[model samples]
Structures are given as C-alpha cells and as structure tokens.
Target: MKKIKGALALLAVLSLAGCGAGSPSSGTAESSPEGTSGSGAATALEKVEVGVIPIVDVAPIYLGVKEGIFEKEGLDVKLTLAQGGAAIVPAIMSEQMDFGFSNVTSMIVARSKSLPLKMVAPGGSSTGDTKADFASVMTKPDSGIKEIKDLVGKKVAVNTLNNISDSTISEAVKLAGGDYKKVHFVEMGFPDMTAQLAAGNVDAMAAVEPFVTISEADGNVPIFSNYAEPVDDLTVAVYFTSDDYIKKNPETAAKFARAMTESQKFADENPEKAKAVLPDYTSLEPEVIEKLTMPRYYTEVNEASIEKIAEISLDRGLIEKIPDLTALLPSK
Candidate 1:
C-alpha cells in the first residue's frame, strides 16, 4: 500500500459536489476570538485549522465556530474553505489542516487504498425522509423524466465520477426497476450543474442542498431523493484526519472530536442556528438559504450506514475491497 501512495492519492480528487460543498476558492474565516474564553478571560484557545467545503452540509461547523462552541472546548476554530475533497485531502496529508470534512465515500476510498485516515466524528447524515432529503436527483421541468427509472440511458451530471452521487443514483435507478448500468455519468461541479442542466447539456443531476433548492427555483424539478431513495438514514459525510495527525496530537484530536460532536448535536436540535450561519460561509441567496434542506447530524459515526456505502463501493468497483471499519472509525 505504501508503494502505491501515488496511485491512492488520486482518490483525493473525488469531488463533494454531490454533498453540496462550496466553490474551489481558498478563503479563511476565524469566528472565535483568539485565545479568549466565553468570559472574555485571556485563557488560551488552541488555534485549529479545519479544511472544509462551503456547502450546506458543513453549516454545523460554521455554527459551532460562530457560537463559540469550539471555544467552549478550548479550541479557536478557523475554517479553511475549498471546493472539493481533492484540495482538502492533500491539505490533511501535509498537516496543513488539522482535520477535514468530507463525504464518507471519499474517506472510504482513501482507507481502502491504505491511506491512513480515520473518521473522528459524524459530519452529516441523510434526513431519513424519502420524499425530501438534502440530496436528490433533479431534471429539467420539460424533460419528461417523472421518476428515477426514467433516467436510464440519460446523461446525469454529478460532482465527481465514482463517488457517492453516482453510486447512490445508480442504486436508486435500479430500485426504480431500471438497468442501472445503462445510466451514463457526466462529471460536473455542483456550482455549475444547475446551469448545465438548463442548457440541455445533461438530462438530470444528482444534487444536494442549495442546488436542490436553486434548481427548483429555476423551474427544474426534483425527481428523486437519491440519498434516501435507496437507503434509510444514509450517512453522507464525516470529519476526519490522518493517522499521523492523531499520533502526534492525540489531545488536540480528542478535543476537536468532542467539540465537533457538540456542534453536530447543537445543529440538529437547533436547525435555525445552522441555517443562520450559511450566509457566513456560502454565497447562496438568503431566500435560497432559508429554503434549503438540512442534513441530519450525529455524535456517533453510523457504522451500519458506512458499511452499506462500502458495500456499494465494492459492488460498484469504486473501491478495491471493503475497508476495515474497526480500524477506520473512531474508538471512542
């Protein structure tokens, strides 16, 4: 596996557009006061840089940073926003970022290829609503595609090829009684997919929040909730770091995870706070932001949902083999 690190690194290029992460520009934001506690005392709040895409799924982290939730855990959180997993993964590899938020499929692919990575906390989950979810399949209003099965032989735009969008969309079409293998996948970014679909470049798209809401606002219709259509309580993404980071900064890692868990729970229970912070991180309009669907957050990583994803990856030939979940998931 060490000998093939070069080949394995390609897995990092996988996009998180399917998960609705933001554009590919490097922007930084420090939400909490430097080295200050809630009481305004000059206690040291450890500075932490976390690589993340500016998508709806990551609202919890932004909320956590803004609300001083991380500061409550002795962390001064800085969000380093990137467009896709490609940028985040390499940043984590070099210790440029202490941790990253990524779609579970990208992490599974990395672990399967012997890249020493582990999910430290759950970042996001499916809403468990089949009729409505954070991620879905969108088509032009006049496309005549009424259901997932109608997608057969159609060109579907996804954030990246061989990632969650393609896998879950394929499964959805199959469940709809269509020949999943016949579906053609076109690589696209979430930011561009809506326009491309309207321009007739693609028949449909596997879209996530912001886009799902944006597409509908443009008169495009959502035909299926790909994240929920095939699996219940599907785990979409998580926060993670390399084994090297954990080994050198175990305390920091633990603190980050605890803060993240707290943030996720807060976001889930207080959905308004999560939505309120979207403007701070993303460029989406307020109308769209308010209407966008939110993902479920969890303190514990759902091993069952992740295993289902790994199984789909193996069955779809995305990963070489099933990843060792025991080694990949957090011990705590």
Candidate 2:
C-alpha cells in the first residue's frame, strides 16, 4: 500500500509538471500562470516612467494619471516634469523615461537624429478660433502693437528656439510684413513671459493657453493668435516611447494606449469632469482651469499632421531633413 501511494504521488507530480504547474524546464524560464511567459508577466507589471511638460495642452494624460487609468491598464506610472517639449526627446533617448509629451517640431528634429522616439499618441492641435491652445505673439493691451508687423526689431519671448511658438511667430511676422530675423526671440518659460513683458524685459511674447489667458487678465493682449494664420498643421503635443520598449513589451504599450485613449474620450465627452480633475495633476488653480479654454483631446496620432510638421520644419530650416517615420510609428 505504501509503494502504491508513492507511485500515485509521482504521477501527480508529473501531471502538474506537464501542465506547467511545476518549475519550468531547466532549459527554459518559467512563465507565471497569469501570463504566457516570464517576459509577458514582467511586461504586464512593468513600471512606466512618463515625462511631461506642465501645460494645459497635456491635460488628458494628466487626467489619465490622476484618474488611475494607467493603473487600470496594469501599468505602474511615474511622471517627471520636463522644462519644455524640446527636452523630452533627449530624456527618452537616455532612458530617463519610457514615455514623454512633446510637440511635433521637437519630435521631428529628434526623429531626424534617429532618436528611436516613436510617437504613440496625438496630444493636441491648433484651431482657427483661439490662441487658447497654442502660442500667440502678444504685447501690452495698450502697447499699441496692433499687428505682427509691429514686432520687427522688437523683443519677442518664446519658450524655445525653432519650436511651435517661434514657428508660429515667424509665420505671423511674415503675414504682417515683418522680417522674423529682425524680431529678437527670447527664450522664457510660459509663466515668466507675462512678468517679463510686464517688467519690460520683452516687448512681446508668443504665449500658450493659460499663460495667454493670464496675460489677458493682466492687461496684456495678443497681436495675433497662431490659429488666425495660415500655417502648417503641427502637432501641439504627442506621447512617445522608445522603439525598444515597444518591441520588447508590446502588450504593456498597448495597455497604456488603451488607457490613454479612454481618458481622451472621457475628457472629450465630459468637459466638466476634466475641469474637476485638472487641479489634481496640474499647477493651474481650479479657478484658472475653469477660466481656461481647453483643446479637444485626440487619442490617435495623425500621421499626415506629423508629416506636415516635419515638412514645415525642413522648409523653415528647423530640421535638415525628415526621418523615415515608418519605424517610429505603429502600424496604421
């Protein structure tokens, strides 16, 4: 009876082993029952490090993080603040982050450098109606600066060189018969633009979103919003991850995308819900957020729009050339 019981126990062990209930074959790593392989499980629980520039343009991702949507997608997300869109690509290349929010201009330049940055989501775009989303070259309400033509040889504040703000300002200047080269471009953070303009450090600034709204509140007025001009369709904001990260962990990336897309839908369908959640992730005051005009959230990246930005940059000498976008983007 003892011999028979021992034999039965051995059979049971063998059954479990064949069913992957026991340790993996010595030659192969074991996968958790929760997933297909050890790598698959690892991917699911992967810690996602996301980088963002603090601006209302990126509110959907903020809302996603604040709402725990990434958590719901089996990702542990960490956010790092970047100085501007231009800084985000280098952060991704150095592996300082797995994902980041950046503008199309920077993304194009990075792509031209073969940075391995893949744009996974669209962040925002310009509209014809307002400067509430993107930057507009502005002066004091009573500065008597009626048009972009007035900016020639005057100090202009921009968040960065060769970015959306500068590009928009250049276009606006051309339309107003001002030479962009004559306008002195000053690099300043959005928050500092108004103060600098007020303090007489800058004659005008191309400011975005809440900054534009805040400047208006402070009696600073825009000469022209980018939306009012005919310019290339540029991506105002986008989400990216390294190609290596995506290839190694497709499921994890997909999960992240699903969560972000859902959040975009939520923000689109429920503006008040977005207003309620903005303060949880952004520095914008609730009242300021309430007063701000937000952009429509879009989940999918538009390839044509991205290409247009690259084309514009190339035309405007922001980038020497456009990169092969195939590898840096998902299958359409």
Candidate 2 residue pairs in backbone clash: none
For candidate 1, give the lDDT of residue 231. Answer: 71
Residue 235 in candidate 2, Cα distance off native in Å = 2.4
Best by lDDT: 1
Q: CA lDDT of each candidate?
A: 0.81, 0.64
The digit string of per-residue lDDT tens for model 2 on 270-316 reads 77777776554444555456667666676666677666656667777
TM-score of predicted structure 1: 0.91
Model 1 regions lying over 4 Å from their true place: 1-18, 35-41
Q: Which pairs, if any, clash in model 1?
A: none
The sequence of per-residue lDDT tens digits that candidate 1 reaches over residues 1-332 is 23222221222232454355555456889866766546877897788899888777888888888877788888888889876777788889998999998888988999998989988989889988866888888898889899888999999999889989899889888878999999999987766777788789999988887667767767788887878868778878899999999999899999999889999999999998899988786655666667778899878888888888898889899998998988888876
lDDT of 1 at 224: 79
